[model samples]
Target: MRKNSSTTFVFIVLFLFAALIFVFRMQLVGISGMITNFSRPLQAGLFSVFNHPSNETNKKFQQVVDTLVSQAQMNQLKSDNNALRDQFATANIEPSQLLPSRIIGLPQFLPGISLPEQLILDQGTNQGVQKGMPVIIKNVLIGEITKVESATSLVTLISSPNFLFTAQTQNTNTLGIVKGEGADKVVLVNVELSDTLKIGDIVVTKGDKNLTGKGLPPGLVVGKISAINKSPSALYQSAAIQNPIDITKVSEVFIMLK
Candidate 1:
């Protein structure tokens, strides 16, 4: 009976081992599908902690863009200031030529038939600007001051009706008085009917002390001789000049501070 018991114990031990193996295989198969449910959440939590940024990404991007925009604006302002400084240096040496100033008012691109063209500037007596100063546009003399305030001034064109300039004709080297002819034209008076005087003769300022403005710069452009009278010319006293500054389309002007 003891031998029979021993054999039965051995058989029970083998069956238990086989049953444990089968249960283990079944557990492994069951865990394969639910393994994702368990491991994926843990993996995602770790990734959030280690891989992703804790701060707002969009906000950071906006800050970077704003910084770049501000830098660009500052650069533009710096460039503008540098250009103005260079212009100032050039203007000071030749104060009679032009002084850099701002356009405070532009009454007309093309004002009207009744009203003459006019432009107001931010420079006046405050910045050494004085009456009769020739205002230049892009280095070309365009007009003269009509009025002045403490910090502002008005420029009237040489094409204006009441304008006059003493000019020296290049052909004859003779002096003449240039008076406006109301329609972008001027009269060069006291021109001798020499063989030198002809159509297309260039006219420039004679640079006399009295003919220049009281506080204005002289030797600026007056006009060009567009036509001349002949038929033995009846010994006329004047020649017609084509004014240079087109009064209808002036944008910027520099006031001379001589």
Candidate 2:
């Protein structure tokens, strides 16, 4: 009776093992698709419940990014518009609308050290630029067109040693020749000691009397009087001008060809 009981238990165990293997193989081969079909709705429902807040959070983050980008673009547009307005205000000729360009190279003239701070315009005669054209950066006088080419030109900076301009004192109404010193300094030549020229006086071009224009336009603000020195012989008084335009920052300019 004990042997019969043992045989019956072994048969039951063998049958259970065979059934387990069959179920596993069926799942691997064909039942996998069935299991996915049955579980998809459950998975989707669980995701909706758990991920709804996360999706909203992601949308908020994206909105923040979009706001930042829009602000940056608005700032850039405002800057560009301000620059354009300045160009229009300072420009002289209707056709000579102050166009923008990059400084590709430094001004090269024979026997002079060019100041890179003074801008060199990229467009030249090809862009209707001509000799005697007035070049200005941000409404300040820089230089005038000296050499013209099909695509390039040389601007004679007012700070050059040989540069000279006929400028009048804003306070004194006194006219003198403004000549560039070796450095960035300029001298008000032949000014009389009694002419009432003083330090901190503003200087501007005497357009009607100016000869060279010194790479500048008539009536443009040149600089202020920084210092006044007298001649030992009392023959003349020399004054130094403090230029307004920071040459180093000159990037783009407008050429006014009359």
Candidate 3:
């Protein structure tokens, strides 16, 4: 009986070994495709688990680099501005006396008839800005402060139809009234026909001799004459003057206190 039991166990072990050999042969005969198909999802899962965090880390490092570059540029601008202020002091022109301000508000056109003809500044009476104060950018006259509140002011652009200033031509020293003609254009009217009023003549502010020193500084560029309209019958010649300032691009300005 013991011998019979031992024989049955040997037969069972031999049958299992034969089944394992058959499976190995099937894998060698192109049935390995099934094994590969079973492993595809596991391979993708391992890739996602390991690579996703690395990609996120790379993106975060790029953002940090961008922020550092922007900060460096801002620091450079501040340094250059300080140097400019010191240079102005050397010229005996008290730049410290001038109030530097930035444009804060721009014209926002709505669906209706509302249009903004002026700019809003961040400085106002609280910052020593007053009405009628000349607003300039880099020594060029662009406009004047028309209204001053406690913390803000309104600037009437030189392109406004109601704005006017006394201007003189550089070559001829001929005086004329520079008046805004709307649409970023000005006209030098009342120029005598005999004067050397020609196209391309540069115009500048003609200072006044009033007691309160209310006049704009002389030599502040107004614009250059682009066209000259001369008529034999008319007593005075009018010329179209091009506005030097592109108001849309203005970001910073200064108000002359003295």
Candidate 4:
């Protein structure tokens, strides 16, 4: 009878232990889930820290790139300044008489099909730039200021249809009226038929003080004579001028301030 009683007691203890386990199962599962969720975020954070560059590293890299770009721009500006100084010296022009200007905009046209007839400069009336000021690259006349605002100016290129100036040949001193036919075609017309015309003659500004004042200085190179058209029945001859510098490629220029 005592042995049977002890077996009953063991069975009762086992039953109570199973009841406690069942009652606490949900709480145990919740604790385990909480621990797993906490560890997941920690693991992800560590992985990101190891796999990706830090914000400071990215910032430093960007700073290095910016410095390189700034240095390149500085070098380019220095080169341009040196070139302008050399050109001024060669042209016998005083640097003080020139207001260095940057080309901010180019005339819109189909590339390789059309030519530029105008340019926008960064200087305007605020910089003492005014209409009728001659724009040049060294001793080569490119255009003149036609309009000015407070901070910008409009330049009408020598190749514009409305552009007209007096020019003369360097070799023969033959005088003619320079006219623009658009599309980068400039012509020297009204030349007397008896005047000597050559294929390689250099054309320069005739420098009329009464007509344009200091706007178009004398001896400024306009272009070279590429072709001459003459007719026995015509009253005058015309010559095709080839500009030395491609106006489309010009980035910087000087405005005669005097």
Candidate 5:
């Protein structure tokens, strides 16, 4: 009877060992799938902490984009506001007298020279923008319209080497032709050597008319004289004129009707 009991105990131990082996094999085959089912509620939380597209990361990226956009918008608003103020202050001119237009395009290089000379406007013949009309930005003369289309027009910037306009000194009241020297520099020519054009003297349009009878009005600020070059051997004195406004930064302009 004792021998029989020992044999039964050995069988029982063998059966338990076999069961343990089976359980281990099942876990090895489907361990990953079992864990996913068990932790489904926490899966999203784990991914957000470890992945690149987390909520925190998205918020940070959005903030950076918003800052950049806000800065750009603020700059544009300032420019527009300044333009409106200039229109109101200029010669007490009514808004109906001035035609507002945006620069649609700018040339890569000026014609006949490698400089920024030309720009295109959104106005055309339909808007009464004719060739040779003066283009001003904030009461300052920038260029003249050279070409006209049905819906667009081309402008020649005063800084171009090919551009020339009649200007006069404010303090001395001297008349001279302002000629572009490339690189945003201009030279006042044909002034008498004895004329007193001092540094910091303001220059403005002379309102001289062309054969077409259209001309820029007097008292429109052009630039300021920065240097004077007088030669005893030369017939007239010349000076370097500094433009007040940066042409590259200009976006909108006014086409004077008169």
Candidate 6:
């Protein structure tokens, strides 16, 4: 009977313990939810601090990149300006008379095959650029402004097939018509047979001005005569002219303002 009484006491203790646990289950769930809510923001803040590509970090990185880009652009502009100043001093041209322009585009062609016919300049009508204006580097005539836009211009190089200008030998004053034959080849054509032609003669522009005074200035070096073609049967003799500077390599030039 005593053993039976002891087993009944143990069962009572177990039942009371289960009843207490059931009564507190909802409170325990509420406490767990409160803890999760409180830690969520803290966890997120810590993660952001450790992460390399957070929103704040990205904004700072972008600001740094923008600053670098602006600095590089400013440096390039300064360099271009300095180069133009040097060129003006070397050419003995008044700064007010020449508009400095950067070559923004080059004619596309295969290397070692042909020469460029035209160059695209950064300055245009908005910068006082006009068509038929002479483009030069130092004292050498490179091309003329054939077309103009608001912010850009096209220069037809001296080696273009359509280029035509009157030129004279610097030493002898032997006059001939300068014509372009492509592939960086220029020819002094329509020369009289009696005019003295030499292989090493330097040709220069015989300046011509229109009523508006927009034209090439005299004494701009064109090129040196490479070979003389004097055919006895032909009425006029021609000579091949070689430019001292490679037009394709030119990065800057000046436009003579009218």
Alpha-carbon local distance difference test for all models: 0.59, 0.61, 0.68, 0.74, 0.70, 0.73
Model 2: lowest-lDDT 10 consecutive positions: 110-119
Against the true structure, what is each candidate's TM-score?
0.53, 0.55, 0.59, 0.61, 0.60, 0.61
Candidate 1 weakest ten by summed lDDT: 88-97
Q: What does candidate 6's lDDT look like per residue over 1-258, in tens digits?
A: 999999999999998887887887543545544554454456445433433345665555446434533443444355457768887532232343888886666655663355678877777666888899999866678899998766667899898896999888755669999998877789999999999998877787877667987667766778779999999999999999987656544556889885
> Tens digits of per-residue lDDT for model 1 on 1-258?
999999999999998987997877554534443553454445445433433322465445446434533443444355457769887532122334468865545453343443355666666566777777778754345678888665567787666676776767554566777776555666787666564666665565555555343533434455567776654646745678775454433334577665
Candidate rank order under lDDT: 4, 6, 5, 3, 2, 1
lDDT score for candidate 4 against the true structure:
0.74
Over 16-97, each residue of candidate 2 has an lDDT whose tens digit, in order, gives: 8889878775335234445544544564454344333345555564464345334434443554577688875432323446
lDDT of 5 by residue, 69-113 (tens): 344344435545776888753233234367898665655654324
| Better candidate by lDDT, 4 or 6 | 4
**TM-score of model 5 vs. true structure:** 0.60
Task: Give RMSD to native, each candidate.
Answer: 35.9, 29.4, 29.8, 28.4, 27.4, 28.7
Candidate 4: minimum summed lDDT over ten consecutive residues — where? 67-76
> Could you give candidate 4's per-residue lDDT for residues 54-107 as a string of tens digits?
567655644643453344344435545776888753224334488998676664
- Using lDDT as the measure, name the better of candidate 1 and candidate 2: 2
What's the lDDT of the predicted structure labeled candidate 5?
0.70
State, as a TM-score between 0 and 1, how close model 1 is to the true structure. 0.53
- TM-score sort, best first: 4, 6, 5, 3, 2, 1
